[model samples]
Target: MMDGSMFIDEWHPSDHYMSEDLTRPARHRTRTQSPPRYYYIDFGISRKYDASNTNPLELPIYGGDKEVPEFKEDYSKPWNPFPTDVWYLGRAIQETFLDRYTGVEFLSGLVSDMMHSDPAQRPNMDEVFSQFQVLRQGFSSCKLRSRVAHDEKRSVFHFLLHWARRIQYIVRRIPPTHTSLA
Candidate 1:
């Protein structure tokens, strides 16, 4: 099942901060270091079904995010959790990333499909991954290396300050997106 608990502060490793800011430093300001790794947890509701069973149904067990469309219509009916998992992932990305940042417009199509109200209309994991690959390949390395700006407009002072840091990052060849050492 797609539990919203998949991502939380506890699941991510702490970063080695070089500044006093309580939040994560901006990409340009971040020091060159191994990127933090993140993983999922809370498998209290997870299941492992036989490979032969393509459609396994289970009763709803509400997760961290209670906004799933399927569960809203009928709470007691048995439903396949696979498509719901796709919805969870799509909604998570939509809320956590797309809504808050710019430069990821390429993901809109796939996210829309995954979050379809009709579960059967959603693409399977393999299709999702394939589409993601195509999207990823479409971006040039320079585009990928460019800074991801926030959706909100910054004040004039902040904008100039951000550009100053951006120039420094460009000169130093610091990547706009952090990478894992492994």
Candidate 2:
């Protein structure tokens, strides 16, 4: 399921939050056999280029969070936004999952490759997917899955705690006169 406010030209404050959501456990669906794949949505500022064109134009438009280093005004030439997307995804993975979790060294390495400062050095989506396939095979039926499961359980506990506090706050706001049944 999609979440977050959709912003076209305006800067979305929840960009990073939505990015983190990608790493969370997917909603279970009985009809679906494969795992959920996250996709970039709300491309309000997205531009279309000719199929024959390989080079991305240096547009003045700066979209999403300003975390992308290449988008800095000082950069001499315009670089491809495709690589910028790769960097953002890498950063999201690092900030949302790897830095907070344990036993995902291989995944961290892959993210590092994507977040490399040099846009040219970053792997395309195909290469990234292939690498993920290889790395995932190695981690399959191992400690990584257990670690993720533990993290999920911890997240659920924390979520419940947060909501409990909110509920307590709402309950405290009610007047004492309302306690008696009519």
Candidate 3:
């Protein structure tokens, strides 16, 4: 999580560019060490299915990006939600990074494939990850390393500040009489 509050997948403008205030020393500036790694969270609704079960449970689409065409009422048939997840991820990446940044043509095709309207056309997670590995190889070493370094530094600062605040809160809560315990 960037800044301990925003998820990288959520795609806020701040995630792409650091504001001056955030870059200041007080905010615990991020170091430019390695490429930033993203983590997926919020798995409260996640489920596991056995591979033998050809017909996985298909409940009516409830939460998530409302723009998914398959979620329409007219599409009464239950469909695998996995492809929907791919679409959402693609859309998030496109809208958040590709749309705002330039010189990432390598990712455009992959993103397009992921966002294909037909779920059958979309590549599976393994294929997507493989493609990403290939594409990442094309990035300039300096650029990739610098980006990672910056994010790492920022993360360190955020971690330290969070702990500091917690400690401060606990210290304040201690009774004054307990300050000089024998």
The CA lDDT of each predicted structure is 0.72, 0.60, 0.60
Number of residue pairs clashing in candidate 1, backbone atoms closer than 3 angstroms, sequence gap of 3 or more or interchain:
0
Clashes of each: 0, 0, 11
Off by over 4 Å in 3: 3-31, 34-36, 51-57, 73-75, 140-182
Which residue pairs collide in model 2, if any? none
Worst 10 residues of 3 by lDDT: 173-182
Candidate 3, RMSD to the unseen true structure: 14.3
Tens digit of lDDT per residue, candidate 1, span 58-130?
9977888888899898788999999999999999889877998777777899999999999999999889998
* Candidate 2 wrongly placed segments (more than 4 Å): 1-37, 73-76, 149-182
lDDT of 2: 0.60
Query: What is the C-alpha lDDT profile of model 2 across 8-108, one tens digit per residue?
Result: 12322355333334553333321112233346677788788887776676654576568676766565566777787788889888877787765566688
Q: Which candidate model has the greater lDDT, 1 or 2?
A: 1
Model 3 TM-score on a 0 to 1 scale:
0.58
Model 1 lDDT at residue 120: 92
